[model samples]
Target: MSNKKQKMDPRVMRTRQLLRDALVELIDERGYEKITVQDITERATLNRATFYLHYSDKLDLLYQSTKEILNDLLNNLNVTFEDKVEFDFSKDADEPHDTFMHLFEQISLNSKLYKVFLTEKDIPYFFSGLKKIIIDFISNGINFTQPDDKKLTVPRELAVRYFAAAFLEVIVWWLENDMPYSPKFMATQLMRITVKGPYLEHPFGK
Candidate 1:
């Protein structure tokens, strides 16, 4: 992050934003199938060379935009819980709930980018990136003590997968309905169900 890069000229930033905005607008208006690099460049008032300089292809641009948005979220986040937060269908913390709301606020602000990422063909890796974020957060937040407890039967992997899948489902639903509910409301709803699970006991607690 050089000073020059950080303080990119307003013109350059404006061009980049134009390119992204153009692509998103095109995708919304006509869908990805009918969109082309030339369409995006023409809409942005930039040439093909400029489009290439910013992104490799439409798919690349889509994913890059998503990655940039997610990076912005992860870098700015501050999730705090009181204890070893198990990656389970349990919800208990106000702070983590607040943090999730913040993340979704970021997501809501860029819903078009998300819709394109989710519905676009040949982009399972986008979901994988979302999973990785949850897994990484859970792994880092929960400290295991055993020397060989990498597989401590905490069901960490499955839990991470569950959270990712469930959360994404909510997000997709939100996008489909044009996000009628606030992000915080949706997140709090999720947290209540998820965090309440671990406290309940079954016959074998399975």
Candidate 2:
């Protein structure tokens, strides 16, 4: 009764990768709403039956593709979190927090796909799913124990939501503007705002 997902066969994995790539290309060229299963299959050089064997519809394909990317982002963050190193925002901007930098790098690497999904494709669920992932990750990483002198004005859940929403907006803006800044710079900016700014300070006073 392990909840882990079973490993997919190599051939199956390749096929799915093809389908996912095909979908992203199609969505980029013709937007998501106009895309049909035939378009994906044709682009993938795959048959309708083969596509159906893996995904029920284009939406399913989109969800699975996005989920895979988000899972990778979460995994990268988790690795840095596991290191148990405290993030020092005062350090040189060239040396941002590892977890944030890694997450931003993942987004930058998949910038094209994210651009299509977040802005061009008209997928509301993408944002919703992304928010949920961010919230879950932050919630798990938060330390519930605080010193006796500090008091929290806002609920822990509210703070998580606030930060997650703000982070999502920043990501959308960055992708929309073609990422004017480097991932390291963007990550550093985010860390500064979240850690050193008044938002966290006013509510979670030390």
Candidate 3:
């Protein structure tokens, strides 16, 4: 963050948080379409100008807060991965499974925010964020591989899109079904299918 954003006062932070909380609550009670900037301000006990200073509109606030949630998720993942002493996936796959479950747990803890993300009104931003993360991961992974043929191939982008789409679909299904399965179990099953490439022909081929 820049100095401008970092230099906010504690009071200002409190007010912003209040507005965000109020907005989520309002959306839960009613719906995003029916909620207005005035409603958020009134619920937060803040002025319209204050709301404007923080956000141009409700969607902007939603995007900003969701980004924060993503950043926190990434930070927690980094912490989990960094603390590991060994990095053997076949032998130490449980760590990744646990990490993924932790991510699900984080999302579950904030079901309201995720409910908004799963909704048609706000799903685009969530998918966009997921796409960006998958793109970066696949890009870096491809960069580390030496091409076998004369031409340079970058099919990892396609692979990333495929994987992210599948992942998002699974998440949306879980959310829509009220997440009957625990995150740990869901992560275990997904990790198996992903790492093992299914039980049949092997997705990546031997």
Q: Summarize candidate 2's per-residue lDDT along 1-206 as a digit string, tens digits.
A: 01223566778988988998898898888888898999999999999999999999998998888888777766667564446456444564346667778878988988878777887647777777778877875665444222222465677777778888888889999998999999989988887777567453477566
Looking at model 2, report the run of 10 residues with the lowest lDDT sum.
Answer: 141-150
| Residue range 63-180, candidate 3, lDDT tens digits | 7877776775655554343344354546554445445676577778776667666564634777677557645543443343323333444365565567667777777788878888
Q: Please tell me which predicted candidate would have the highest lDDT against the true structure.
A: 2
lDDT score for candidate 2 against the true structure: 0.77
Taking every candidate in turn, the Cα RMSD to the unseen true structure, in Å, is: 5.0, 4.7, 4.7
What ranges in model 3 sit over 4 Å off?
1-10, 45-53, 79-85, 94-102, 137-155, 198-206
| Structure candidate 3, residue pairs in collision | none
Global CA lDDT computed for model 3: 0.67
Using TM-score as the yardstick, the better of models 1 and 2 is 2
Give the Cα-based TM-score of candidate 3 against the true structure. 0.69
lDDT score, candidate 1, position 76: 46
Ranking of all candidate structures by their lDDT, best first: 2, 1, 3
Kindly report which residue stretches of model 2 are placed more than 4 angstroms away from their true locations once superposed. Answer: 1-7, 80-82, 86-94, 120-122, 140-149, 198-206
